[model samples]
Target: MKKIERGMAFASRHVDIFKCPVCGEGFEEVMNGSFSCSKGHQFDFSKKGTLYFLRHGVKSDYDDIKMWEARRFVLKAGLFQPIIDEILSLIPEKNYLRIVDVGCGEGSTLKYVEEQRTNREDAYVGFDISKKAINLATRDEGSAFFCIADLAQLPFASKSFDVILDMFSPSAYGEFDRILKSKGLLFKVIPNANYLIELRHMLYEENDPQYSYSNDKVLTLFKRHYPHAKIKKITYEFPLSKTFFESLVYMTPLHWGAAAEKIDAALAKGLNKITIDVLLLIVENN
Candidate 1:
């Protein structure tokens, strides 16, 4: 089947989860190139099979195709399989539960979980602000719904999702609370100070290894929003693939503003393996 055909088929399957971004009405159906509401608010799906939910032009560094491609490649190596396992473990054993992934760049993390799970009754939706990311996400996988939408203003209905996955992505707790059902689970993963420490060490000054980090304030904010939040610190080391070494460098924002000379210098050192230390927060909407 064609990519757009697959996309429309997926849209047809989960048309209920979408809310018109402009009129705030439930989508009635998917027409030729767009999803429309009864009130006539329409959002067009791209030829690549993804919908754009942004109301305005908002450019970010995450839109780079090279970055997302690199991310797709590295993540396929299962470097963060532990986190995926934890996410799957938190999911209730049922069908037709709505799951949304906020800031789902390239869609690899959620795709991996969906592929691993046996249940096919659950509806999976992924949202990212980058159209590039969403395009890549929906390129081949038509099973899950993909939208280029903002975190602050989700195009999904209130009390819609059963589980929200915020993996290394920015969070809008207020928006999350508004969209999730009561007692809905939110699984968030934030990088620890030691996450990609070796890469940081290589890209920056030798005197300032600066590998350790604190999420105290982040946790405090989560607790303020969701009183029943639980935290887990996961730390581990994984060997780097010889082939994906360059991809690892490009896949992250860690080296974003670093001087090219410095980046080149870091690459010369030849990083072998890196640390994967992150804090996973499982909070409930009340």
Candidate 2:
């Protein structure tokens, strides 16, 4: 079956979680492969089986197809398996779950999570601002409900989700709080100082300011929003092949601002192994 057909079926099963992006009204049902709100604002499912919720187009540096494909390649190679395991450990052992992945690029992470939970009934929804990313996400049939949505203004109903996953993505705490249940958990992952250090060194000199990194500001901001939030530091190294290293180089935004020569240098130098250092912030909505 086509993606739009799958999406329509999925929406029919879980239509209550969606809200009209324009009018903030609940979607009553799926009609003609589209969701129509009480206010008459309708969002049609694309041929790829994804919904577009952004009122206006937003361009992003991550919109390139090659970048997203590279990311999907790396993720599928099991480089991020450890992080995914940690996220699964935090989820409650419930019979049913409603989960959303904010800024979920290409839906790889969400798809992995869905695959791991075979015995339970769970609803997985992933959204990103990049249309290309969402389109790529729909390639995997029955993976999840993918959509193009703005994090600043989510198109989900209030208190609808049991868990929120933000993996290496920007946070919209206010929108998170609104969509998450009162006791819902949010597992946010942010890069640490030593994350991809090999590439960092290649991109800049020791004395260059960009060579060093810190997550102090991001931690402080998160703490300010969730004073009682818990943090877990995950650090490890994954061996890399020359082929896989190339994917890593293109998948990350770390090279976006670097000079062409620097990227070329990094690719030429290659990497034996890459560090996977990140902090996982687990917060509960009170």
Residue 49 shift from truth in candidate 2, angstroms = 1.0
7-34, model 2: which lDDT tens digit per residue?
8888888888988889888988889878
Which runs in model 1 stand beyond 4 Å of their true positions?
A: 206-212
Q: How far in Å is the alpha carbon of 211 misplaced in model 2?
A: 0.9
| Whole-model lDDT values for every prediction | 0.82, 0.90
lDDT of 1 by residue, 108-225 (tens): 9878868876566777889899888888887655377788897878888889899999998889988888888987889999888788888887777756434345667887887788
lDDT of 2 at 90: 88
Judge candidate 2 at residue 142 and give its lDDT: 61
Question: Once superposed on the true structure, which residue ranges of model 2 sit more than 4 Å away at CA?
Answer: none
Instruction: Give per-residue lDDT, candidate 1, residue 128.
Output: 93
